[model samples]
Target: MPRYLDRDRLALLAALVAPLAVAVVLLTFRAGLPNTSIALILVVIVVAVAANGNRLAGGLAALSAAVWFDFFFTQPYQRFAVTKSVDIQTAVLLLVVGLAVSQLAARARRLQVVAITDADYLARIHDTAELAQSAKEPDTVVDHVTAQLTTLLHLRGCRFEYGSLIGHPPRLEPDGTVVWGRKRWDVDRLGLPNREIELRTFGNGRFYGRFMLDPTPGTIPPLQARLVAVTLADQTGAAFGTVGSG
Candidate 1:
């Protein structure tokens, strides 16, 4: 069985049957011949299936219409066999055209959906980057990072730990080391197999404490990871200014 059919059999069935039902109603109750109305109804069915995010459903709808058209609309009503040559040719042409139209429309709809999803992702990333850049205080930055990470990646929690190199490394207390600068990554380590996104600011051959993200597996793609790294680096550079420049 096809994946789409397996995933959405009921929707596929509805897409296939609704147009035929409309055509039957048109033939039985409304008038003698459906004329252009039948074709319009079939087009509507294709559009509806495409709108529902199943391009295969559109093709299925077209196939169902061909079968229904031959059985009901063609001469010698309620029969699979067609007597007239022109009617047979017309049915074949209708089937071919409907299938082609549905396929093309479905492809366009799929592309549109992808474009919208990508646009939304970009917008959210941009907003997060802006918020990160605008944060002046350490606590504020940590809060923003935690909130954004939770919203963007749906993580359980986020905490940053500044290393010894940044400004001031956290001191080791009597029981454990008290890290002042480094954001805590202990919670992140609890989640298995996570990607650590590290962003660094380099000046005078020295690296500043950078932003880090522990992302869930398969949630962040390579290209997106690279982009986030670049954005964070840019934001850190803007915050600290050029340390070595004359």
Candidate 2:
């Protein structure tokens, strides 16, 4: 999610604007349109807002529409006071319908996002397995690992650390370390923003090496990063085993 305002926040603002726009257009012919017809039209606008936004946004839109309708369309115009029971019914119905529609739309959007995420994860898993299979040598395996990780974690760059301790990879830490090249990775130092990470590769019950990575900002949450790190370590461990076995 963005640090600034998102679609939902904007929707709230839109809800406020929709009524004023509608009031301008509809009030022009307020004398010609029946109260019931105008009420139904306002309800339609509220429903649309709710469908495109969250529950709170929808509720706000409905309330605004009802308030405007009462002021401009009902008797005792330009006032908060309502005279007819029918007008009361109209406002209540509009608000109730808007809230209901917003709830349904919000649920649908959440499910849709989940479905897409699931599909993408499956694809990534398949690719990881395929890359692991094709890698025969340690360098090739390490290269593949780095590339896959860079893409998976939305990293800026990732490179394998091959040294004498290649067979003694570091243990996984709850708080992962960050690295970028030989110099310490820092936006202030590198003149740009980056999330650098260091993850060890342990395969076939022995350590292979570690990969230094710089991730894209705000892509993976802590829990998800740990999950990805574990998977990568498992794959790397398997590849290390294969290199020796071959």
Candidate 3:
């Protein structure tokens, strides 16, 4: 599955399905004639809304039920405009139920999203911790970290550069090279001709180096940057241990 949720498609599907499901349920109970159960229809609407996780679906289901109830089930049937007091109460109740269910379902969906994000973040942290503990050589750690990051974020390619920043910034060729920033070290988003991601890593309050992604520019978002930072910091700390403060 794609990492991000496609809200537009979900909303569109909810809008289309809710009314159709309600219509089907209404038709099923119609054979009994004058025995239509408004409670059953409301239950169906609530289920549909909860299953779909959309407010639009719930609202549409409520409206469809109200219209069907007045025209088919109410006395002096076959008209939209309600004339009876009890019918008015039923319509009001349907609206309230639909809105309430939809609100609750939406809240649940939001929680599910947050949980998924947190899980991904924790998994990244676990991977970094494992790399820090297991790798004896800094290059081995860097290569392992790069491979893990590429797999985790689904990047086409990744490279890490190490060394102090001095002299003019090195030309960031299609391949990787270390470069100096104009001034103090910071994470600068470098734009390439094609859609590529460039992440600069800083550690111990100083610039370490750049993490380059293949092709174009602006491909990596902020969350990915933080993950890369954690992995890079692990590798950099390992490098310092091996080389003794380069």
Enumerate residue pairs that collide in model 2. 202-237, 203-237
Name the candidate that leads on TM-score.
Answer: 2
Cα deviation in Å at residue 1, candidate 1?
18
Tens digits of per-residue lDDT for model 2 on 116-172? Answer: 123233334334544555566656666766777777666778787753243322233
**lDDT, candidate 3, 1-246, per-residue tens:** 552346535654655555555655665666673322553454355535543545555566556655666666566767677777766765555554444344444444543421112334334443454444445665665676677657655567878777544344323321122233443222235433243345555445555565554532444333333333444444455454644343
TM-score of each: 0.39, 0.42, 0.36
CA lDDT of each candidate? 0.49, 0.59, 0.49
Q: Which ranges in model 2 have alpha carbons more than 4 Å from their true place?
A: 1-5, 111-246
Kindly give the stretch of ten consecutive residues in candidate 3 with the minimal lDDT sum. 170-179
Ranking by TM-score: 2, 1, 3
Ranking by lDDT: 2, 1, 3
Name the top lDDT candidate.
2
Better of 2 and 3 by lDDT: 2
Name the candidate, 2 or 3, with the larger TM-score value: 2
